[model samples]
Target: MLFTQAKGRNVIALTTAESLATVTGIAIAPAPARIAAVRVKTRGPGTQVTWNDVHSFGPDAVTVRTPDTIQGDQDTTAPTDKHHDPIGKRLLTETGQNLGSLDDIDFDETTGHIKRLIMAGQDIPGERLLGAGTYAIAVAAP
Candidate 1:
């Protein structure tokens, strides 16, 4: 399992499920001898819940021993790859305002991949505020 940051949020993946349903297939594969399941763990001050490794394979069945008990399952949901805005593409605001163009992306330093866009906007005095609020900055797409 792998833990990554996407859009300033943590993304959990058993395997790279970017395309072709990659992670889902591997998770349901026949259990290996030593490796039972893949567990995705999030570590940091802002994240939540930690435990010993969890098996990726689903349990056959379960029955509650005590009354008023609940059962929960954990699995990594696939990442969104809409690709509406291609890399280096320019996107405008809903109000038809020239917000900015996509610059580069900032990835998790530990993971070494893109996490957020490094948008560069026009050099207006007040415009900096707009850029600061945006995950995508307004700059010439390169």
Candidate 2:
């Protein structure tokens, strides 16, 4: 799901199966990989959660925050560098062949890594990436 759509969903603590948090924001890493982390707000005094530790995702809720899990960094919501946001950027091959434009990203919830790039209704494996910057996302020629 797009980060824009996921912003306000309820965040459920999996261990308790309770709704204790709401997704507040997302942090996109400013590199070719576009690793993303979610920021969640809890109902306690300064209780905030941030990480890619999503257990399951659904239209109604997202399960997260395990009992023995350490909370992720709070400052990951903001980008740390000058790299471009990949969404909407053009998709091209290393040979300069135009494929399409990036539409969304699919990530691995277990490892917090980007798994694929969704572009023009097609799935491009993250391993095919060559570079992602201000211009476009270049992948290996297929």
Best model number under lDDT = 2
**lDDT tens digits, residues 19-101, model 2?**
76776654444244545545566655323344545676576787776733324454444431234556677989988899989
* Residue clash pairs of candidate 1: 37-56, 100-138, 106-115, 107-113, 107-115, 119-137, 120-138, 120-139, 121-138
| Every candidate's lDDT | 0.25, 0.63
TM-score of 2: 0.51
Task: Estimate candidate 1's alpha-carbon lDDT, on a 0 to 1 scale.
Answer: 0.25
lDDT of 1 by residue, 24-134 (tens): 110111111111121222232111111212212122211122211111133222111222222344545434466456444432333222234435753222112222211
lDDT (Cα) of model 2: 0.63
Error of 1 at 110 (Å): 4.3
Clashes of 1: 9
